[model samples]
Target: MTGTDTPEWPRCGHTDSGERCRGRTVAAYPACLAHLDGTERTAYLASLTPGADLDHRGTPFTQSLLDELLAPLREPGSGRVRVGEAAFDEVRFTGDAELEGIDFGGFCSFASAVFDGGLYVQDACVGGDLRLSAAQVAGDAWFDDTEVKADAWFFKARIEGALRFCVRRIGGSAMFKGMMCGDAYFSGARMAGVTSFSEAVVDGEAAFDGVHFEQGADFTKTRIAGRACFDGARFLVNSARFDGADIGGDMPFTGACFEAEASFEETAIGGDLSFSGAQLAAGVDFRRAVFRRTARIGPLICPGRVDLSGAVFEAAVTLEAAAREVRCRQTRWARTAALRLRYARVDLSDAVLEFPVTVVGRSRPFVSPEGGVMAEPGLTGSRVRVTSVKGVDAAYLVLADVDLTGCLFVGTVHLDQLRLEGRCLLASPPPGPRWIRRRTLAEEQHWRAIRYGGGWTPAPSGVETYGPGVLAPVYRQLRKALEDGRNEPGAADFYYGEMEMRRHDAAVSRGERTLLRLYWVLSGYGLRAVRALTWLVLAMTATVLAMMLWGLPQAAPDPVSAGTADGRRITLTTTKPEPVNPEGSYAKRLSSARLEKSMRVVANSVIFRASGQDLTTTGTYMEMTARLIEPALLALAVLAVRSRVKR
Candidate 1:
């Protein structure tokens, strides 16, 4: 009923638009201002004053009505709309609305309000919270240069036009939960309070460039249909999250800085992800983040960890980070991925590679893995190294120009298929009495010290270093890999390692171990030609000495007759002399003639030939043994030389 003719003392039910009215009736009038007659409405309008507390909940206003309602609030000097606590909940503005330059003194709410035209509230300062929860704007909405002392909420608000916001500072929490907008631009905003856009949907490009959040900023599950750019944005306080956000186009975080942890966990980007010129002081997580296109996530300074664990990339990606750590555990790549890093301990455990992937080190400005060059200012050239590749199928994995001095190859699959290019540094044995002469794995050294030195070098914490039995296969596989790569000379070291492991392994048969030990003692596991040749020389020397001392007789055996014929009466007896040891001092036994004879016998014995001169039993046995053992040592020397020089 109209307030001018109403007789009842009850409140007005709703406005002309059928929205239930919550505004109080004026004086004795039973209806609100909208329901009052022209005379009564004019009387009610006169009662309103500037900066007065306003509650127009569920009120529907046309453009003229909105203008009339806002006309009184204009500040006397500044002519800007100034108001105290205001509630516009469920209010509808039928046409374009301009509420810009408004100074709010206390709490203001426009929750569930509908704006058929652009809603402009630029340069507004709110003393208390400003809420626009579930508000719908058919046109653009602007909140640029706005300052809210208390919490500001736009949760579930749907803005049809560009949602432009540049908050000067937000004192309390800011929420954009489940809001849908187009062309979101929040650039150059400084937010002092924590902000969240969780589940917010942006239909067009969303740019947060140069926005600084002193507190946390969350974009969790905020799907952006167009490009998402956070270039130069700073998150200095709490962790900035983008976890589960699905970005349709390119997402650029170029020149951005996140002091706290920045997460992109499970985020699906349909285009490129670039983080060039950014510095993530705390860790940056890309765990399970799938990029349908290339991800250029480098040329950045990450003092903290960068994890790409379980992330999937559709195309080539190059990461050049000065990071503390980078983990690619179970990360899958459809194409190539190049990691040019410095001072980062990369772990690629269980990573799946459909194409080739490279982990390279760079201390200087060099071409990136994707064949592009990055800005090289202040490049430290701190070596980028791989610490572990456990459980990685290395068939398509490559290490180029990286420091692998501490890379652990335990539990790696298809390890023999790994491709090595450029100067891939590996650990070598420490300086010892004997030259190690070859590069080896650090794990091998660690395990060897434990097995042989009775716990000399400590194993990794909480895990036992593999014993010889386990290391033997690793060496064998690597040797095969190098050999398959046509690096036989390089394989020699691994071959030696394999033999050493086998000799120490209890899994090996005792006879094999014994033979291996003998081989090692005599020939350095058939890889040291000097050891084999030296043993060969010693055997020949012993043979010569034995022959000179006991094999030669004092005089040449002479024929003597002693038999007499007993039956035929015409037989002559004959006896043959045998060789005897020379009856003289040891010096006499080393006579030049005897030495010449013994040397000749020993030289021929090296060829497995018997000397024509008869020798004593001990000398004959010595010659036979020398022929067998010395020639074997000589063959070992030959094999060692071949192993060193083979193609």
Candidate 2:
């Protein structure tokens, strides 16, 4: 038989285009030499020698031959297949290529190898480097539960179906750079070495859920057309980088733990990027990253710095951290983007927030994009809680629109020179008052608390707190910001705060400092008109009482002795009206008249006017003091009222 027949004979089962081979088989064989059972098959089977350069290009592999080829690798530490240059290019498998549990002893290359079916390498051990670069896989590439002792490279490889490496342990570097494949699964995989997927393109979803990386991982320039997940993945040490990655779908990192530095710099995300319940122990960099959708990172434990400089959040960006160590510096939010930091302890010392920063509370009007009347935004819409904001730089820091009603500011903040679209609200909401007739004990207590103080104390001293004079700058800036926003009432409040701070600062001149304190004590630094009026009334009343107690001087008829020329004088006594008893009712009426005149004199002195009654000061010093103080009180009251009105 020449292995070529048209009669009733078995032909080679292997064909590139599914055309039956014309070559006949040997005795009792089902296929020709190319498939099996011929001189060529025998030579090919015998060529599978140990410790040799296995060149299997343009050849076909049967299950039995593959078994025999890997039989040596199956022995535990006994035999090695050291193919110095593994050439399996364009090789085909007649059946499923099962290389499971086979240990590769040296560098292996299957570049451009074609798998007609799935490639199963479950629990396989690569003793040295393994390269499947540019290999074309028709079915799933299963490397689950395998161990790669040396570098594992799949650069530029194309897998038409799913590629799984779940639960596999890679000891050395695992690189899939520039790989274009279907769904890529690496869930529960443990990589003790560097894992790189730079410039890779995945057509289907890419999952690395619960994977553990002992070293750094790089996914720079990767593009995922489907959903990408790293949920519960742990980066134990070194850096985990995802720079310049483009994710078309959701990229959730829920419950992920990063023990070292983690970076997503310059990445572009199309869907929601979530990190809820994630634990970040080291520094995280998201500089220049672009989020097309919302980026929610809440209820996380981040003890390290989170650099978000130059990052663009197209939608809302919500972050809630348990630790205040997270810093948001120079992060950019789009005009439509809403930033919420609920129940978080964070630092926005140098953060820049764009305009239209509205929250849920009081209603403020805003025109819709369709050019129609829309309900005003609310103040308490979303809450952003922070431990401190030391020196924040905002594009438009409209405190009114930047609803901080839900925020608890424990640190001193600087609000300087930022554009204001509306009012800036910083004061607490006013409590309702009770009418005098309907007030109860509880109502009275509430009123007392409001009138006296709320029992608030200064925040603890830390980096967020500035020393004595340092707060003056903050108040100054805040006043300027309020004035710029055209909130004169709010500006006046902050101006008083600024002046009060300067009064306490040692840097101020002694005279100015003393004057400020006096102003505050007398009339609340010209801010309390009621207090100024009360002091004026009290001073006038005291002067009136004193003048009443000490009677005014009555100019008696000037010495009534008729004086002659200087040499000799003759006395002519003037006739006196009938004398009255001093203790009699008439005498008492005269004394009352004197007292009334004294009261008028006191009132005239206080008003800075001459008394109509001819009354002289019985207590000259007291009168002079009254004259000086009454005018001062009047001036203070006028100034206080003017301030209240101007504000």
Candidate 3:
């Protein structure tokens, strides 16, 4: 029954959009060219010519049949197959398909194509855009050494095996939006326009070694489940954005270069994120980025601002970028960290540092992860300067070899616990017109300008401003911190600042304020030995002049002779004439005898001893007055001197 009935062409089962095929069939085989087999498929392909347009939609092909179709198009001299526009939509490849060294003269569409085996288009040239939208590739998809003149779209394409683009260059953008792939290797691929992988998912490792992206590279919202390596990759002139990228493993861009901005805003890295030896010529922003493991963000050369504001680190991190400015504001570090920066102004305001964080200005370049030095020429400076530590928890903060002269520590918490090493400096107030004051805080100057108008510039709008009530404790804590390090002299400036703040504090009692003011005026709060000595010398000179002018008598007094009558057992008292003012203003009062007597009286008065000399009626009162005030000035001078020399 089967032989006579002849199977009836099997009713050509292919369908599209719920419509049965209207495809032509020939020679009792009753199938289209794509479905033909054996001698018949070969016979039809033998008639195909080079550079001819072909339509093979929904074709199901074996490797041999596919090769046969491209055979006639091969160029004779160099074996370069050149074809016109081709459509392989919904085509199913049964085995590995090699289209290497082929040139497509027009657009190439493999839309919704399925490759059961590897798809190789290596060394191929596509004159127009290459579209593989919604294609499914089970084995490796090779576009290596290929050149696409127009855009390359892999939208929603899935590759179970590796996707490679080794040495492939693209003229237009490479769009991989929502693509789901396995391991990807793009080593040495150069993309002329933007290369976007937005919302794509990578299940295995990604290696983009030495790739050059001429415009930009965007990985926004990409979900990478494996480690991504971009060692030596270059983003030439545009920004490289990794915003909202979720990296499951380590992402190392070692030796990579970003000529423009590189942003990782809100990115989450489950493993270490490294940029060892990377050169970021423009700014790099990592705001709100989270690192679950250790991050090695340094040994990179970043000349622009490197911002890590609002970033949260769950483990230790070492950052050694030579950035101009580094902002760690509101960054939360859960474990011990180190920042070895060069020529950067670090801002750690509101940083939640749970463990100790050591920051230092490195004199030498940082060592890269591979044990190489990250040295760059022409850096202006190699010091890490801390500009603002306001709102920082300074309990476990350590600073070494840093410039803090202009640093603002107004809102720092637990400041007394801060540890500073290697020449930390605080700024001093500028010289006053009539006097020189000790070092003071920057916030104090602002407050003084507001209150007393010393011409200090006002803080910018929304900038934090501090008053004496806020500054006094700051000075006290800083003073204590320096003192704990056995830097007594270093703490002197802070102590003076504390007293000045106290004198200006409205919260202090009026009497205490007056006393502090007096302390400041008299001897610079007992810190200035020169001021006290100056006062001491002036007081001594005035006392000697007054004693010579009116305090001493005209001549030496004589003791009474009556005491000799009872020389054997008599208790005798010496009696002198009543003291009176010298009456001669013409010339008689000026004498050598009076000068000698005045010297003795003044000397004795200074030491609280009696000067045995005959005096005028006004002289006795003057001697008592001189004894009281002169000694206090001398004592102040001595105290000032001792305060400076003490440990």
Candidate 4:
């Protein structure tokens, strides 16, 4: 009821719409019921009984009156205060409200409840839940510091400012689902039960730094328009999921620890996703996650596996961590930027990596059935890059099943220590004999025995079946790679391998093969200069031994003139044995000098050297054969030396 402006009793001095209220005061009160003082607040509150239907809506109560009104709710076994649809429209609370353990019978709403101070509701046991849906608070909401027993529901609740929660024990599930709010600080808060924010849109920064989820944290389909940080947060129990979450800004998960399964499947991140230093005890599935920008996942410690299959990244994505196993099958690393792995130990068994990708560091050993523990990692079907790879661990790389049919290599393709257990298919099928050599029936049976048996078998084919069939192409590529790197020694090794394969080719004629094998056995395919020199020494010794076997040739004794009875003189050849002299004799001395000259001539001729001495010609086929043999050996030796020096 409106009172006169100048009434005998004091009217409400509270201003509304820039004007004072015209309502009269209560009995013995200075102001109206809407604006009562603290001294008269108790008298007004005492008038109501325990079961009284209080309808103090729109009334401005002092801090003392509000405390006394809610005093009964703080006690145990106190009946519910039936404030039927009590409205607290635009109510300004001045002091900290300790409304713990408050029971409301009906839908009690403080829609526009403005708190100038903080709201402390520790261990609040409410029979009817405090559905403060769409409630507005001015100060921080402290539902945590004290163990809140209420199922904290903040559906569509808007805080005009910021809020923080402590490590409070929640009795039931706390849902901030679909709540539109400002900055939220959830540092060190442990929600002991189920927590959900499905479809909730946070307009300001949501910092869950160091927060622990004892159960599950479901943020499925949630949208965060600002920065969302979960740094150092721990998910101890159920799955920590952010499936289909759309993050508008950066989401830094640095140092976060997850004990259970964590999934970010189908999540769309507009900014960078940083998981640096994150520790995972269980597996994390990021399948189909779309990163609009870069993702830096490094310095991480994950003992469990990580599945990132089908993930797509628009920008660069680098993995610089150590984990037990990483599966990225069919993951699209980037659209344009490089996907570089530094110090990562990944098992890219069936992965499809985009071009311009590089890997550097040691990985798990690649085991082969035929060849025992091959300490290498395999990139089975990934595309080879020309300029991306640098300083990779070539010693432990496995490219057995890799196909380099169309790959163009610009730099060194180090395959010296590569494991090629599978068929080393380098190029496509060309127009040539499918099998390296003709496999006879006996050869085939022998190969089958080698395949099934434990030990080696003797094959009918001159060359072993697995000797050079698939290794030819591999040797070619290896030679090219080593040559590009300017490693001449390594290149020469592969070159020898290539030559050996050609020499063993069944298409090669027997004559050519005989020549090639002869050279190979004698001098290491003409690449070993020492072998040629050793053969030369043996040839010289053999020549000297043959000379010793046959007596030294003395120039045909000068035709001797015998005294003829007639005037004509006749030449006589002496075939008589001369007596041997113990010391010096003219015939013996002449024989020794001739032997020395003949030995020197034979030695020089065998080594393809010119000798000044000329021996008397003995017209015999043996002499001609000896001359041809020495020249041929000399030519082979020269070729061997040339090949080694040029190589």
Best by lDDT: 1
Structure candidate 4, residue pairs in collision:
376-396
Provide the lDDT at 196 for model 3: 93
Kindly report which residue stretches of model 3 are placed more than 4 angstroms away from their true locations once superposed. Answer: 1-30, 37-43, 270-277, 364-383, 435-437, 450-457, 561-583, 586-628
What TM-score, to 2 decimals, does candidate 3 have? 0.87
Regions more than 4 Å wrong, model 2: 1-37, 43-107, 116-118, 337-355, 358-492, 497-524, 528-551, 555-614, 617-647
**Cand. 1 Cα-lDDT:** 0.82
Every model's TM-score: 0.87, 0.62, 0.87, 0.54
Candidate numbers, best lDDT first, in rank order: 1, 3, 2, 4
lDDT of 3 by residue, 243-280 (tens): 99998888888889898999999998887667777877
lDDT of 1 at 516: 95
Error of 2 at 55 (Å): 4.7
Instruction: Give per-candidate clash totals.
Output: 2, 13, 6, 1
lDDT of 4 by residue, 1-647 (tens): 11222434345567879876544455566565556766576667666544333444334545665666765333345543433233343345666555544434433445445566665655433333345555556555765544434455666666656655563555566687776556677887767678888877776778888887778799898888778899988887788999999887788877687878888899887776665656676767778888886555544445565667777877766654344456565566544333333222343333343434444332333223244443212223232211111223234333433333322221223445433333222332223443222111222224434654532244434444443444455467666665654555445555666666667677768898898888776766656656666776666555544443332333333333434344575655555332222234445534555556556756666654546433333312223444656666666667756644554
Could you tell me the lDDT of residue 207 within candidate 4? Answer: 88
Q: List the candidate 1 regions with Cα displacement exceeding 4 Å.
A: 1-29, 365-382, 429-431, 434-443, 454-456, 551-581, 591-621
